[model samples]
Target: MRQDHASCNISVGSADLDLDGYGNIMAQSQQIFDCGEPLALDIDEKILLHGTSWKNANSIVCEGFDNRMCQNAFYGAGVYFACAACKSHQYTCNQHKKCCSCKCQRTVIIARVALGDSYVATETRKKERRPPVRSGSSGTYDSIVVKPGLIKGHHKPNQVHQEYVIFDREQAYPAFVVEYTL
Candidate 1:
């Protein structure tokens, strides 16, 4: 059924609308407004909302399911830098600020030298003369040349010195070097 009216009269109380946390208006009443109708409301209303002022926000913290939703920011020097989680290390230059690059090491023998293993030598032995003199006589000694004794000694021995290079993961070039004596 259709009713013909010259003008439509309606009254909306203060309870008709609800304001959300951000002060956005939410309609509560089911009053329908027809096209080409002069509408009327009853009360003058203003609602308080939240997070409307920029000065109220303190810290920048964002979280989301995927990488597209969350934003990590470095707020400093009046600069609000916002970036995705994947690119945060590059944006903040944190990748270059490393404490130690090398996590593993490998030892390699660079050089080895060999010296004389053993040597033989000779010595002079002093022999005392026959002591037949009485209590007042001093004993005379004679120097005799002796054959080379079986003296055993070693010279500058061969040594195995190793030079080690440290690397991180599969890095092609070494980060540092360490020397070891074996």
Candidate 2:
């Protein structure tokens, strides 16, 4: 039996009713909602019950699986902007607050590329003019170049760069170009 609360909130859980073999409600109690606050639930994953809170919260981190039980949110200009890294299925347009309508991860990728993939290349080479302090640190170094591509010997973590046009000494810009940077 489905009982509507004050609004559209439909509370269901072990405390709300006693379920029998035939999916029948055998009893009712004072408690409601598997957990009072928002939560994530996985199949074959057990959730210990008490009053209105979860006994084992597991972790605050939200893996791909945890996103299922919660509503999807876009990159908002609120507290979400404070995060060092926030991956949403929606593009984060700083200039405009309008969120691009997207369905899956690929949609987000296309949106991101359209919004900020220009001046960006995915492949880079670090030609060592001279050997490094270590022995095996010379020759051409291959790297996945991000924006503002690093040169001969200047690369750091979390540093973005802008990629310019391509040029080959004696041939075209290579036979193929593969981009995989994010």
Candidate 3:
């Protein structure tokens, strides 16, 4: 089993993006996903990749285009580059060079779940089911008004559970959020 950490994912199936922009699908290469909503990656998922770029800033934040860094660096020595080229570089999930090479910020990873094996990714986080449970459900089955029958886990616990990253969410994108911080 391959162990990894990751951040938010962008889907490949997103409809609005120009399909002709990125080069032809390289053999078995996957497609790009769409992110209908916005999300953030925990520090563990996207490591800080520092470099210098001359492009204008994407937001009021900074002009750091390729210079921007992932909040969470992969488990390795940062990203590997074929030079200064942006597309030529790749992120390593493992500290070694053999682990899966995560290209593009929204790269998908493989994961095994309680149901079965599948793919999950950062890009699809927004597409998944995020049902909101009422506080009463947490109250549990109280045989007696004074006693609670079952213990219920928080639907989405506070940020503490967001600390470590899971690396594999499902495999539509392999990477999922584990435990993380802003």
Scored by TM-score, the top model is: 3
- For candidate 3, write residues 61-171 as lDDT tens digits: 232122123233322111111111122222322232223343413222121111111121112122222212213223111010001112133233221111111222221
lDDT of 1 by residue, 142-162 (tens): 111111223123122321111
Model 2 alpha-carbon miss at residue 110, Å: 28
Question: What global local distance difference test value does model 2 have?
Answer: 0.19
Estimate the TM-score of every prediction. 0.13, 0.14, 0.16
Alpha carbon deviation, residue 132, candidate 3 (Å): 16
lDDT of 3: 0.20
Ranking by TM-score: 3, 2, 1
Question: Given candidate 2, what's the lDDT at residue 64?
Answer: 12
RMSD of candidates 1 onward, in order: 47.0, 25.2, 19.4
Q: How close is candidate 3 to the true structure, as a TM-score?
A: 0.16
The Cα RMSD of model 3 versus the native structure comes to 19.4
Question: Which of 1 and 2 is the better model by lDDT?
Answer: 2
Off by over 4 Å in 2: 1-123, 128-154, 168-182
- Model 2: how far is 166 from its true place, Å? 1.7
